[model samples]
Every structure is written in C-alpha cells, then in structure tokens.
Target: MIQLLFILLMIQIAFILILSFANPLRKLVVKGLDLLKQGRGPLVTKTVAATMCVVLSSTVYTITKIQKRSKDAGIVNPTDEVLMARRLLEAAFLGFSLFLGLVIDRQHYYIREINLLRKNMETAKKTKSQRLLKEMSGN
Candidate 1:
C-alpha cells in the first residue's frame, strides 16, 4: 500500500511539472489528458478516487480506535504504536495524492483555456488587419 501511494504521488508530481512548462511535451500531455477526459475515462478516474477516499477514511477510523483503546488502558503497547504509525503514514500519502490529483486537473483545464483564448485573439488580429488594409486602399 505504501509503495503504491508513493508511486502515485511521484507520477502526479511529474505530471504537474510537465504541465507547468511551455514545451512540446506539454502539448502532448494536454492532448493525452483531453483523451482521458472523454468517454469512460472520467468514470474510471472518479471511481478510483472514490475508492481511495473510502480507504483513507477507514485507515483514520482504525487509528482512532487504536488510540481510544490505548487511552482506556493508560498505556500504549509496542504493537499498537507501530500499527498506529503505519496507519498515519498511509493516511498522509492518500491525502496528498488526492490533493495533487485535483491540482493537476485544474492546471490542465486552465492550460486548455489559455490556448483557446490565444487562438481567438490571433484570429481577431488577422481579421482587423485585413479590414484596415481594405479601408486604406479604398480611400
């Protein structure tokens, strides 16, 4: 579980880095993301995210239960201490991965919007230039 979470976090970080720059790879990554958002891709992504949330919740619940038991006994056993630490690590990784996923999504969306606006601006410039040339020649 720890390994999986670590790998996911790394992948998300790399993806964000790729999206942060203006490069050929960024275009490719954005195009790939566009395809991923189409069809059943979104459904699968949401399902996986939901599953991670459920698991994270369960880990937190377990940690609380362990803490309560220790408080009632007035002492923490070694086994319970180790288990609690592991659960905490898992929760932290899960939370971070989820948050980064959201950030990546938002960044991708804004990049797409920026590209669209740039295209529109260029088209308008060209049209205006053509109209000015016609007016100047007619006058």
Candidate 2:
C-alpha cells in the first residue's frame, strides 16, 4: 500500500509537471532529442550543456543534503542507500527544471526564427512581383 501510494504521488507529480510545462518545454524535449540524434546545431549544444549542469548541480545539492542528514542523524556518516535516494530525488528535480527552461527558451528561439523567415519570404515575393511588373511595362 505504501509503494502504491508512492507511485500515485509520483504520477501526480509528473502530471503537474507536464501540465506546467506543456508549451515550449514539451516541444523542446522532442526537438532537442531529435537534434541530438542528428548530432548538430546550437539547439542540441545548449540542451546538452543544460543537461550536464543539471546533473552536476543536483549531485552537489544531494551531497549537501546527505551531509546535513548525517549531522542530524548523528551517525558520523550516512549509509549509501540514504545518500543515493537523496541524490536521486535532487537530480530528478534539477533535471526537470533544466528541461523546462530549455524548452521555453527553445520555443522562443523558434518563434523568432519563424517570424524572421516569414518576413524575409514576404519581402522576396514583393520584390519579385515588382520586378515582374517592371518587365511587363518594358514590353
């Protein structure tokens, strides 16, 4: 029953996370993973950097937690199990935060790029039409 409760809690947490990050974050994850497989570009590079930072920061935070726990428990040192669980939870949250940030940032970049592309395309079409009109008048 306890295990089931934990699972339900985790599911609820995950749902909230997904809901909170439903916009660009979700899109960023899919795009970043795809970019990773393709193995190129600034998007993938940023994602990889963000991911590494998340992992390292989470490790540091978890170690600090373990240190605090050991001091509180007065056990001189904590067991591997306790420390590992603490670290895992810290890492999970950090990773999620990083992922969410990346997604939002990536989404913004995508929107900007799209806007620029559209503007360029519109300008090109207008110029081409003008050129055609000039040629028609000449004839």
Candidate 3:
C-alpha cells in the first residue's frame, strides 16, 4: 500500500512539473486532462479521492489508538513502534498525493484559461486591424 501511494505521489509530482512549464508536452497534458474531466471521469476521480480521505482518517485513528495504548502501558512495545512508524509514513504519502492532485487540477484549469484569453486577444486584434483598414480606405 505504501509503495502504491508513493508511486501515485510521484506521478502527481511529475504532472505538476509538466504543467509548470510552457512546452509542447504541456499542451498534450492539458488536453489529456480536459478529456479526463469529461463524462464519468470526474465522478471516478472524486470517488477515489474520497476513498483515500477515508483511509487516511482511519490511519490517523489507528496511530492515536496505538499511542494511547503505549501511554497506558507506560512503555511502547517494539512491534507497536514499528507499526506506528509505518502508519505515519503511509499517512504522509497519502496526504501529499491528495495535495499534489489538487495542485495539478488547478494548474490545468489556469492553463486552459490562459489559452482561452490568448485566443480572445488574437481575435480582438484582428478585428481592430480590420476596422482600422476600413476607416483608412473610406477616408
């Protein structure tokens, strides 16, 4: 499970890096994201995120319970110590994955907005130039 979460976190980080730059690949990535958000894509993504959140909460609960047990016993068993450490690592990875996912989503959204603005600006410039040409010719 930790390995899986680590892989997911790495993928998210890579996606964020890809989205941070203006390059040919960035356009492809943005297009892919656009398609991913269509139809059932959003529902699946939200479901997965919600499931991860639940698992994270459960891990936290387990960690707290382990700590309480150790406190009550006045000593931490070696096995409990190892288990707590593992759980903490898992929680950290899960949290980072979720955060990076949100960052990637936002980056994709902004990139799309920037692209739209560029298109609108180009269109406006063309129209303005056309108007200037008509006025000059008429005069």
Candidate 4:
C-alpha cells in the first residue's frame, strides 16, 4: 500500500511538472474540463477547493495527533503507513486544485477570445453593409 501511494505521489508530481510548462497539455485539460463549467463552474470549483483545504488541514492535524500518541505508547512505525497514505491523499488533492485553477484560467481565456471575435465580426459586417447601402443610394 505504501509503495502504491508512493507511485501515485510520483505520478501526481510528474503531472504537475508537465502542466507547468506544457501549454498544449494545459489547453487540452481545459477543453476537457470545459463541459464541467457550463454552469456555475467557478463557483463549484472554488467550493470544492475550499472544502478540500478544510479536510486536508483537519486530516493532517488528526494524523499528527495519532502519530504523537503512538510514539508516547512506545509503538514503532505504526503511523508510518498512515503517514504515507496521508501524503498520497494530500498530493492528490493538491494536484486536483492545480487542475481546477488551470481550468478556470483556460475558460476565461476562451471566453475572452470568443467575445473579441464576435465583436470584430459584427463590426466588419456592419461596415460592409453600410458601404453597400451608401453605394446604392449614390447610384
């Protein structure tokens, strides 16, 4: 179980590192998560992140207390496995938070791009129509 947790932690770290410098991957991740944001995306993502933060802090505190109690009782390595598991859980949550942030950033980028395009298209069409009307009236 510890080995499995270690492997997962490593994978999460690798993913985060890749996401940091990989623009294409970031776009893909954002597009993939776009469906999730069709409604209340930011709100839901923020809520989840806040909830995870609370859970993570509480879990860490509980784990530390357990470890301390075990140490006082002269237990050896009893908390070692639990600690590894906790670390894995923490890493997973952190990775998720990072992904959510990226998703929000990408969503905003796309929204802005789309709005700019629409504005430009409307301007172009309106100008072309006005020019055509002016030419017809002058003739």
Candidate 5:
C-alpha cells in the first residue's frame, strides 16, 4: 500500500510539473476544463484522457524494468505488495480516463450553451442601450 501510494505521489508530482510548465499540454488541460465549465462544445473540450494513460503506462514500464534489472532483487510482488501498488496505479488511471471521457462528451454541448449565453448578454446590452436612447430623446 505504501509503495502504491508512493507511485501515485510520484505520478501526481509529474502531473503538477506538467501543469506548471507554460506548454500546450498545460493550456489544453486548463483551458479545456474552463470551456467545459462554460458549457462550450464537447468536441472542443479535449480532456487529458489520453495523457494519464500514456504517463501511467510509461511510468509502470520503467518501474518494472528497473525492478527487473537488479539481480539482488528478491521476489517482486511475491506477496502482492507490488501487485497492489500496480492496482492502485491502474485504478487511478482508469478512473481518470472514464471521468474525462464523460466530461468531454459534453464539449460540443457546452460550446453551444456558452455561445447562447453570450448572445443573450449582448442582446440584453443592446436592448438596454436602445431604451436609454428612447428615454433621452423623449426628454
């Protein structure tokens, strides 16, 4: 369990590092979530679903390879400790993927909803302006 938690912590740190960078991936994840909250197009919302997968797989592979290289290494996961850690990583990645998929599915719908809200706000502003103009003219 501790090992799994450590793995998760490492993965979380990597994610944080990625987010801290001023890169396209960071923008995509942050901006995508924003658009999603604004009810933008689901298609436009490219959630980082694939990201966790690629990261987790590569990380697990590297870790496993490292463990295999040491001849002094006793039995790896012989008592399910490593297996449990693997399961934790797997669960975290799988759950993240599903959640992103669901959220991104509404990407297009969100876009349309945001557009409608903008249109409404603009119309309201124009109507208020026209009303003010009429009042001034009458005075």
Candidate 6:
C-alpha cells in the first residue's frame, strides 16, 4: 500500500510539472476538455465533484469501521494502512478534478482571446481598406 501511494504521488507530481509548462500535450488536453465542456461544463464538473465526495465518504467510513473492528479483536489494522490508502486515493481524485477545472477555465480564456484578436484584425483590415480607397479616389 505504501509503495502504491509513493508511485501515485510520483506520477501526480510529474503530471503537475508537465501541466505547468507550455507544451503541445497541455494544449491538446485543454482543447479536448474544452470541446467536451462546450455548453454543459459546470454541470459536468459539479456532478463529478459530488460523485467523488460520495465515494470518498463511503470508502472512508467503511475503512474506519473495519479498522475499529480489527482493533477490538486485539489486532492493529496494519498501522491504519487502509485508512491512509483511502485518503490518498481521495486526494488524488480531488487533485485531478481541480486540474480539470483549471484547464477548462484556461481553455475558455484562450478561446475568448482568440476571438477578440480575430475581431480586432478584421476591424483593422476594414479600416485600412477604406483608407486606401479614399486615397485612390482623392488622387
């Protein structure tokens, strides 16, 4: 269990590092989530969060009861290993959900920025063309 937790933590750290950088993989991930989020992003996020909460609480409760029973039977629950495992798993899921939310928000911001840039470019082009036409007619 400890080994599994260590491996999971390592993977999570690596993932966060990768996300911190500006890379094609990050862009792809953000773009994919953005596509999925189109109109129902909030609903999806909320649903996932609620589900995680339910699962985490239930798992914790079960582990705690098992540990208590084992202690009553004059045995240690392996240093609370099961509880630790459950909490670690819950943390991982929460972290992933948070990362997903942040990515979706960033993608939305990028999309808005792109649209704004396009509009500005089009306006500039139109004005330049109008100015050129006026100059030609003036001549």
Leading candidate by lDDT: 1
Q: Can you rank all candidates by lDDT, best first?
A: 1, 3, 6, 4, 2, 5
Worst 10-residue lDDT window, candidate 6? 1-10
lDDT of 2 by residue, 100-134 (tens): 55654555566557768999999999999999999
- The TM-score ranking, best first, is 3, 1, 6, 4, 2, 5
Going through the candidates in order, what is the number of backbone clashes in each?
Answer: 0, 0, 0, 0, 11, 0
Candidate achieving higher TM-score, 1 or 2: 1
Per-prediction RMSD in angstroms? Answer: 0.7, 11.6, 0.7, 6.6, 10.3, 5.8
- TM-score, prediction 3: 0.98
Compared with the true structure, all predictions reach lDDT values of 0.97, 0.63, 0.94, 0.65, 0.59, 0.66
TM-score of 6: 0.49
Model 4: pairs clashing at backbone N, Cα or C within 3 Å = none
Give lDDT tens digits, candidate 4, residues 104-137.
5665566558758999999999999999999999
Candidate with the larger TM-score of 5 and 6 = 6
**Residue 17 of model 1, lDDT score:** 97
lDDT of 3 by residue, 50-115 (tens): 999999999999999999999999987999999999999999999998999999999999989999
CA lDDT for candidate 2: 0.63
Model 2: worst 10 consecutive residues (lDDT sum): 1-10
* Weakest lDDT window of 10 consecutive positions for candidate 4: 1-10
- Where model 3 places Cα greater than 4 Å from the true spot, the runs are none
Model 5, C-alpha of 105: deviation from truth (Å): 4.9
